[model samples]
Target: MSWLRPQDVVEKALAASTADAQVTYVVESSEANLRWAGNSLTTNGSMRSRQVVVISFVDGGAGMATGTVARTGSPDVAELVAASEQAARDAGPAEDAVPLVAEPPPGAGEWDADAAETSIGVFTDVAPALAEAFGEARGREELLFGYAEHAMATTYLGTSTGLRLRHDQPAGRVELNGKSADMSRSVWAGVGTRDFADVSVADLAGEVARKLAWSRRRVELPAARYETLLPPSAISDLMIYAYWTMEARDADEGRNVYAKAGGGNRVGERLAALPLTLRSDPFAPGLEACPFQVVGGSSGSASVFDNGMATPAVDWISGGVLTNLIRPRAWALNTTAPATAAVDNLLLESPGATATQDEMVAATERGLLLTTLWYIREVDPQTLLLTGLTRDGVFLVEGGEVTGAVNNFRFNESPVDLLGRITEAGRTERTLPREWSDWFTRAAMPTVRVPDFNMSSVSPAS
Candidate 1:
């Protein structure tokens, strides 16, 4: 049987919602997914249910009830509706419910691509291939790791003011890992997309193969700030997190480094140098996600932004000056909705003029190339101070060439400071996961060369 459409579900839920009394909003969502992993082709599948109903009673109060199912029957539905109405009543009065925008203009289609159109079996097969490749690599012991997730979710929303909207997202990720000679070090890679066709396990295996081969040599890296190159994958993770942690709430509380005095906020402040422009674009090719707010449930869908806000496509540290801060809905309302707040996902745009890996090395003069970051954590929320270990691969480059794999080092650095020191960037691209979306990032980055990279300390064991 075809699953319940958002509109149909909304109609049924609304029938139950308005039965007893005042009901401001009723929203519901549902999801189903299939995933696979390992050398074995066992398919992993799951189905999830969610609903959240926001109510406003005549007594000037509001309430909400959220759960995996909408209702069992008449009394259950009555109880839920009553509970929601009472909760709204109990919260006392806030603001009059603002009129949500009218339903979006008709669209050609939902993002639900044909399920039969793709298969993750190839992605499933990649794990063993990576393990096999690692096994073949001389002086390297293959350490196999695997992961895959295929997910789908639907949103059905209804508000008393004639607002109705529905949307859903289907997406997934697949990955593998391999280790080296002493097993003290290793390499990692993964692929992800809304459709399984894009998740090539073989390609993932090949990437691990490169890491296995490239990380053969071990050298000691000297402690000092030096020019460094970052691949695209790593670049994506750092930039994305930089935005997530820079919340307006954090800034207001003076927890963010970019916080300003007198509660005016810091939107256009000069934070970083030129060349770092971070923005969010939901329309970017191959990366479009649902532009609806489901509030962590499987029901009703509102416009992607929690409140009446548009998604931002441009973010800036133009010419290396701090430019924008992502603002969430509640914060936006408190601040009168500045354009600096973003509902879209983050994207760090790099110019086309960046040097290629070879060009970056040629211009390096001397530096280090960091493959991946590990155990990254916050030191100071205000300044973006972070501490993490170099992992998977770390190489020393001298006079335009990778000298060899260097023993991983531990360092503390600021995201703001690191981006500011960039002397050169590479042209290549790699897709990395954002902080909100995935377990580990897969960054496609190019070599970068910086001067005076500080190695605050070293690890006896990496």
Candidate 2:
């Protein structure tokens, strides 16, 4: 649908709202996708939806109800508004109710015409090249599986208070997993980019093939602490966990890793020894994101009921110091602090000489090379300790070269601790984590060398 249609839907929802209630409409429309498996395309699908949410304020209580409609259907705005009003009458008072945004900040309705008009032909044109790459696999024992998705989504937010916001995001991702016949060895390589031209299926296929060849002979090593080299993919995983713990309220409440030792939060403390900087900027080149973050509603600033809260470049860590933490508007107001929103992308930067993954491996006298992490889960919030298994590819380095593929192992480590122990850092590049790629897609991570990385146990899975 064109931009005018989405605006009309929002206007209808607003016109249906009662005097005592505030209505907000959110419309999202996405293009079709293609799914692939076993080296072939499998399914094609598309999704287009719109939802209208009404917030009724009565007797200090606020209640919300959402009504949804598909692309081919009409919305029941009146019924949804009535339901929300009734719910407010039946519920208790809202303790943290704030008025809806009266006026949206400037630049709320910025539009990217190119992104909004992305077509399905982009995926169709690339499918043949991807298939050809897969067919180039050497042996019959090798198998391939993954998906290619092209999506163009527009989010429109309109409030009864006259706040209007809209953003169009175009995204494309290609993931490929290759494995040997016996499932004894495997490798994963993929690309996620807003521009389809950036995704090179040939390079992805070559990397998988190279890694699979390196894993033909397996070597078993007893679990022990060792110096380790982590590629961008593995480092991106650590950064994601670090960002999740940057909530200001959690730290102020004395429950998160950033809680102070005595009193107050650890905002100014030096968290790592290395001069590392982690930041987020919506306008960052090659990693652009929406200019505004969602605010208000039950989920606070994380809500999809966006209120046009402008997102600016935020420095979470600078020069290895704890610099800033994300704060929801409600919590910020209650505590007399500045409101901040969590960012969609993260960038990790280090100074001095930059090296590539291969160069980092060549410099390491003895260490383990981790391709990526899998099934990572938090073990301790205070220390930011995490546990996960190494998968896809793991190797042992001897004499500044990868000697052999090592058995998978479960590792217990913390991003915070890892940064503090960093012996070297290489050049940063946009990378996708094995896990959490769906959410944290944009990251420029570097190869990191850490001493005494804890490998806790062995895993039988490749």
Candidate 3:
């Protein structure tokens, strides 16, 4: 029915399924965006959508099999369920199959609530501030370009095992780019927030202005290993990539970087000397996410059978030691490890790291400050080697201060290996990863100082 709510959609899908087991979920999302270029607003709009996912299980002899079908907007409930069941019968036994999650854990989310939503009104306070920033940029003979977006997705999950769980996740990001009138010098600043309330347009504009001012005197530096300071946004991109590779099965099978030299994963080995802790929490203040598992397809890090499973606080790396990896229940049964679902939000911090990025800059005798990392690609799975390019703003720090902007360079390094060489981690702050923001946006990280960061080559990219 056109009038069906998101919760009704989930309930209808579950009721229509005739398989041995079933799990149904509906994600109702609302998004609002603001885009600007050349110091002028280009467009602003809002949209709403609904997505339905139905997973059906069948017992056709050897073992249980599962199949999933996902559809955008309001789908025909009975037909979708039938499709899922038929898909299950057409496939072979699922290796990751297990009994569905029957009970809710401590933070399984609400059972009855309206779907959270967002509208263009979320940017009510931001528009005027952005206009002011535009005026300031115009007077400075600079151009501003960027986008701001906020979205709220409410998930309604239901299972045949008698569980109904829901979670509302709000994700927002604002990126501001400033360039000189000639477009030769450019810099970027971005922030991540659950709501626009915490984002400060003036502060972001000031940061961009300062970077652009520093770029007035440009210098060329050859590709070489140098002391580097990676800001929180840049660090988040690297750390998030590392976090995505934390699969128990891959490491245990000697397939990835976390694998030990012998035959097992490095679950307890010290990976760094600086006592860094990389963790995820479903309820991390401004970065809160879904408290329970919600997946339409099964993979190395997630399983369709694990729906409604609670995602608690997990310390992937604690005090420089590898603590745990994502282990679904099906894989946990084989490894003798507890099922640890992955949370959507991640944070990396070190105790007593009170220095800000400016403070770290003041302490540096000579180094490079990276604003963003883009075009990242994996080079080697064995050692987690990654290659990417520095973009927008690359500043030269000399004698405990930022002297001027430098040339962009291609970089080669691995987050796992780089962890060991970290000399300092500035205070953790919520920031947006420019490369991975499309997929992973909720992250808090610290500006990290590396003694000898590898700059593979000077890039011609302006």
RMSD in order of candidates: 5.5, 3.4, 0.9
Over 4 Å off, model 3: none
Best first by TM-score, ranked? 3, 2, 1
Highest TM-score among the candidates is held by which one? 3
TM-score of 3: 0.99
Per-candidate TM equals: 0.76, 0.90, 0.99
Q: Compose the digit string of candidate 2's lDDT tens values, residues 1-462.
A: 244466666676678766454545454656667677667778877665544445555554344333222232355656665666676666665545455556565445553232265556777557887778667763456777787776666766667667777876666777788888777778888777776778888888888887888788778988899899988889889988988888787788887888887766888888878888889988788787777765335552353333566788888999999898887666777788787777678988887747888888888889899888989999999889999999888988988988889998999998988878887888878887768887778788888888898999998876
Worst 10 residues of 1 by lDDT: 296-305
Q: Rank the candidates by lDDT, best first.
A: 3, 2, 1
Query: Quick one: best lDDT, which candidate?
Result: 3
Q: Identify the superior model by TM-score, candidate 1 or candidate 3.
A: 3
Q: Write the number of the candidate with greater lDDT, choosing between 1 and 3.
A: 3
Which prediction has more favorable lDDT, 1 or 2?
Answer: 2
Supply candidate 3's per-residue lDDT for 232.
91
Candidate 3: give the clashing pairs. none
| Displacement of the residue 48 alpha carbon in candidate 1, Å | 5.5
Q: How accurate is candidate 3 locally (lDDT)?
A: 0.93
Writing each residue's lDDT as its tens digit, candidate 1 over 1-462 gives 134443544455557664223222222322333333323334444444445444433433252322223342122444655666555444543332233334442321332232222233434554455445444543334455555666554444554445555445455666566665457667777655655656666667677777676677777766666667766655666666676666666676676666787775576776554465655554555566435433322111122224312344555465566665655543556667553434335455457756666677667667787766666788877678887777677777778877777777777777677777766666645465533345433233344555666667775645
Q: TM-score for candidate 1, please give it.
A: 0.76
